[model samples]
Target: MGFRHTLRDDKLYFYERRDIMEQRHNYLKKIRQYRREDRPIVYLDETWANSHMAPERLWLDEQGRGGWKRPSGKGQRLIILHAGSETGWTPNADLVFRSKKNSTDYHDEMNSEHFLEWFQKLLVNIQPGSVIVLDNAPYHNSVVEKVPTKSSRKKEMQEWLTRKRIPFSDKDLKKDLFAKIQLSVPNRKLYATNEAAKACGHIVLRSPVAHCELNPIELVWADVKRYLKVHNKTFKLADLEQLVPDAFQSVTPEMWAKHCQHVQEEEERFWEKDGLQEESVEEYIIELGTEDDDDDIEVRDIEFEGEGEDSDGEQDECEPVMDENDRELLRSDAVSDA
Candidate 1:
C-alpha cells in the first residue's frame, strides 16, 4: 500500500506546480473583486501569551540540546481579544469573556454578557450602519448550546439587546437626551450593530477566508511582531505584559498612517518590480469603458478564464496584458464573426 502511494506521489510530483498555482490565483482575483465592491474590510485574529517565567538558556557549542526548565506555580492563561477596523482609519477591539472556568481559563471573562457590552461599545464607536468584516471564529459564530429545561445565556443577551437601547457615553444622562431620538426613545442610528444582532441601519461584513492580505490588521500584526522582536526579545512574561501596552502606545496614529502610506508604495513597487503596470485612471476607464459609451459596449457578467503568471512566491492574476496585436485581432475577429 505504501509503495502504491509512493508511486502515485511520484506521478503527482512530476506535474507542473504552475497548474496548482493558477487555481489559487483565480481564487484571489475573485476575492479582490468582491472587496473592491465591498466597503470597510475588518480583520479578526488571536494572539497568545503564557504566564510562566521566561525560559533562560545560554548558547552552547553542543548541537540541539536546548530544553525547557519548567517553572513551579501557575502557567499562562489565554486571553482572546477581538479587533475590527475600517478602510477609513477607524478601529475598535473587545476582549472576550469566558463564563465558565477550566484548569486554565482560555475563554473570555463575561462570555455572553461582556461580549454584548463590548460589541455595543465597538459598534457605537464605529458609527451605526457601517459594514464590519470579521473572521469565522467559534466565539464569533458558535451557537450557544442551550439547555432545553433552562434558559441559555445567548437567549438572555439577545432579549436584552432587543428590548434595551443602551445610552452612549454617560449612564447618568437620560436615554432621551440625544437630539436624534424618535419621540421618547433614542434613534437606532446612534448605535453599532453586529452580524448576530441586526438592527436598523447596520451593516456587518464577513472577511474572506484565506485572504489575510485584504485585512489591514495583518499590517498591524506585522508592526506588532516587529516591535516585539526588536523591543522585547529578552523580556519575561511580566515584562511582556507591560511591553504590550507600551508597544501599542508606540504605534500611534502617525506611525499607523505612515505604515499605510508605505504599504501603498510597496504595493506599487511590487507591481512595477514584477513588470506589471500600476493600475491607472486611464486603465479603469479603458477596461470598464466610459459610462457615456452605453451603445459602444454592453456591460454584462462573463466567465473570464483567468491566465496567471508567476511573480515571486505569489501568483499575479488579472494583470492587464497590453497587447495591441491581440486587442486588434479580438476586435477584428468579433467584427468578422458577427
Candidate 2:
C-alpha cells in the first residue's frame, strides 16, 4: 500500500557482488586517505552532447499553440573529455571533437589511443602528485598486457604463459596452464593508464563499476547539459558548437567545489555504511556459530532498502544553482567567443 508507481530503470547485475563491494570499500578508503594527506584530487570522465539537445518542455499560449517545433531527430554529436579538481578545470585538458558515428553509447566514440592522448595532456596540467579519480570505463582500464581468461584458447593461454616466462609443462592441459598463470599473477592486473599516471607522479583511483555518482565530473556534465538544454535555440550543429564553450564556462570554481564536497559526503556515507555492513555480518556469524563449529551453517541474508538510490530515495540530480556572478561570467564568455 505504501508503494507508488514509478518508471523502472535497468541496474547493473553486479552492483551488489562481493568483489564490487570490496572494490567500492577500497576506493572510498583510498579517497579518504588521499584527502587526509592533502593530495589534490582530479575527477575525469567523458560525455556526449547531441546537436538538438533542448529542453523537453516549453511554455505555450493559453490555446497551447505557440510553442516552437522541435528538431526532427538528434543531429550530430560532440564527445567531450576533461579532468578537473575542486580548484577548477585543468588548463589545456579539455577535448571536444565531433563524433564520427551516431552511437548510442558515448564510450563507443572513445578508445584507448584517444584516451591516452587526452590523459597525457591532463597529466601535464593537473597538480603534481594528484589523485586522479576515474570511472571504470573500458578505455581507462587498458591493460599493459592482457591476462588470459578461461575464454582464451588453450594455445593462446600457453603462449601468454611462455611470454611471461612462467614455467609450464608442454603436456599441461588448458586448465592446468590457467591455474599456473593465476598462481603466478594473483594480484590485480596492471593498467597502462595507472602506470602512466604513476610515471607523472600522480595516482589513479578507479571508481567501482557502475558508480558514476562517485565522480564529481559527472555532476559537471549535468550542469553543462542543463545549460545547453536551457539555451539551445536553433538546435543547429554550428550553434551547438558555439554554445558548448559557454555551457562549460557556466561551471565556476565555487560550483566545482560544491560538487566535490557532495562527492565527499557520499564517500563518507559509503564508508560508514560499509562499516555497519561488516559489523552486521560479523554479528550474524557469531550468533550462528563459533569459528570452531564449522558445521556448514547457513548465514541469514540481509537486504538494504533503496540499495542503489541516494539518501533521499532518488538519483542525485545535482542541479546547479547559478548566481548572478556565474550568469555574468557565462555571458561574458559567450560575448568573447562571438
Candidate 3:
C-alpha cells in the first residue's frame, strides 16, 4: 500500500449530486452552442464592499511595525450590480447604492425588485438578442407563478391541477396530486427575469448551482476588490465611494476578454470530465420530492465561500490557471491604475 498520512483542512466540498451534475452539463452545452452561433454572451452578478475593506496582510519591518490602522468595523457597505461581455463593462449598466443592512452576506441587501430595475437598465443599454448569464440567487429566480407544493392545501393543489388541465383524479390524496403536478409540469415554473429578458428579445441562461467559476463576472469582482484592498488607506465611507468607480475602471477590456476565455476553457474541462464520468459510473437518476421535503439543497449567490476549492485538499481541476503572462498583465494593470 502506498498510502501516506495527510493533514485535512476545512475546505469546501462540491457535492456532485446527480441533479447538479446534469444541470452543469446542460448549461455548458447550451453556452457552447450559443458561442458557436456567435451570440453576445453577457455575465451579470452582484457584489458588495465595505468602507474598511483593506488588505488583510501588510509588510512588517524587523520591529513588526508596518501596517495601517484601519477602522474598527466593516463600515457602511455598498451593493454593486453590473453586467459585462468580452468587450468590457456595459455602458450605463452599473448600479451601486448604499446598503440598508451591514450584513456580511451581500444577498441580504438585494431583492427581486431592485435586481429587476437594474436588469431593465442593462437590457436598454445592450443590443437585442444577447444571451445573459445569471446565477441561482433567490432574487434572480423569483417565480412569476408559483406552482403548488406539498405544503399547499389540498384545495389549492386541486385548483392548480384543474387550471393546468393536468387530469388529476378528484379523489387523489395530497401526495398523489403533488406527484401528478411534478410529472405534468416538470419544468413549468417561469422566472420573472427570464420573462423580462424575453420581452426584450434577449435570452437568460442560469449558471448551474454552486458553479460561480462559470460566470466571468466573478473574476471581475475579484479584480475590483483587489484594487480596493490595495488602495484603500482612509477606510472611510466617502473615500470608498470615490475609489469604487476607479476600481471598476481598472478592469480593462483586455482583462474582461481574458476572464471570459478562462471561463470558456473551464466549461470545456467540465464537458470532458462529465463525458468520462458518464462512461464509468452507472447512470444516476435523482427522484424529485415535494417542496416541503427537507433535502440538503444549497441555494446561494455567486459570491459563495471557498469558491473553486475541493474538500479533499486537492486543487479543483476545473480552476483556471494563471501563467506568467497573465500575472504580468495583472501587475501592469495595477501599476497603471496607481
Candidate 4:
C-alpha cells in the first residue's frame, strides 16, 4: 500500500495493494514502448550549483519586508551529462564548467574558448558524422552565424548587426546573452557561405517535442538525481574547478546499467496500465566499414576501445559523403536547423 498527500483536497489518500500493482503495470508498458528501438537513442540534460556556502542573510531580506533578493556569494558550477540505451554507453560522461562569482556577476558562460575546446574534444572522440540529437541550446544554434562569413570578411555582405543597430563586441558577443540573441536571429544559411563546412558534420539532428520520451538516455539522469538525494550531498562550485573526469569516476558503468534497467522496467509498467502500444527505440549501430568478425579478441578489443587500431581494421565501411553545396548549407544551417 502507498499513501500520498494531496494539496488539492488537503487530505492523505491511501492506495491498497491492488492499486500499487496497477500503477506499476502502467509504468512498465510506457518503458518498453520508449526503449524498444533498433537505432541508438540517448538523452541529454544539464544541472548546476552555486557556491558551497550560501549566506543566510542573502536568502532573507534585512528589511523583513521581502524575501532574499540576490545570491549571497559569487561562484557557480554547471554540468552536462549524456546517457544512451539502458545496458550500453559509458557512465557519468559529464561536461563541466565553473563561474567566477555569483549569478549576478555573469561572465561569458557560452561560446567561450573553454566551451569551444570542450565541445571540440568531445567531437573528436565521437564517430565522425554521427547524429547527436540535442535541444535548442544556444551553443549548438549559433555555431554557423558566429563563424566569420565570406561576405562579411570580403565586404560583399551587409553587416546585419550594423544595419540592425546592434553593436558588435567580440567579447560581449561571445557571452551567453549573445547566444540568446542569435537564436532569435533569422537563419542566414551561412554554413553554405563559410569555409569550414565540415564542422557541422558533428551535429546530427534535433529531437522532436514531447519526446524526451524518445530519448533512452533521459532515465540515466533521473536516477542520478535520485541517488544524490538519497546521499544528502550538495555539490560545491570549487569541486568543478578540478578535472571533471576524475570527479565523475564514482559513477561506473555497472551503476548506470542498474539504473537504466530499473527505469526501463518502471516505464514499461506505466504504458501497459494505460493500454498503449510500445514504441521502438532507434539504434546507433551503423555498418561503418567491414572487418572480419573472426579477428582475434585483441584486434576486436582495440577497435571497440578508444585506443589505436590496426591499419587494415581502421577504414570505414560507409564513409560519409557530402557535396560542396550540401556542406555549405549544413555548415551555415541557413536552410535547416539540424
Best by lDDT: 3
Candidate 2 root-mean-square deviation in Å: 14.3
User: For model 3, what is the alpha-carbon lDDT of residue 211?
Assistant: 74
Query: How close is every model to the real structure, measured as TM-score?
Result: 0.40, 0.73, 0.73, 0.39
- Cα lDDT, model 2, residue 225: 81
Q: For residues 99-215, what per-residue lDDT tens digits would candidate 4 score against the true structure? A: 543432122244424444444544444444443444333333333344223223322122444555655554443343344345546543322112121474543443321223434
Q: Give me the displacement of residue 205 in model 4, in angstroms.
A: 2.6
lDDT of each: 0.38, 0.69, 0.72, 0.37
Q: How many angstroms is residue 322 displaced in model 3 relative to the true structure, after the best TM-score fit?
A: 28
TM-score of 1: 0.40
Question: What RMSD does each model have against the real structure?
Answer: 18.2, 14.3, 10.9, 20.3
> Worst 10-residue stretch by lDDT in candidate 3?
282-291
Which sections of candidate 2 miss by over 4 Å? 1-18, 65-67, 166-172, 276-338
Error of 1 at 242 (Å): 2.7
Writing each residue's lDDT as its tens digit, candidate 1 over 3-105 gives 3322112112211234322322333333344346554434444443344433244345478655444455434433435554433334556352222344322
- The 10-residue segment of model 2 with minimum total lDDT is 280-289
What TM-score does structure 3 among the candidates reach?
A: 0.73
Deviation from native of the Cα of residue 48 in model 1, angstroms: 2.1
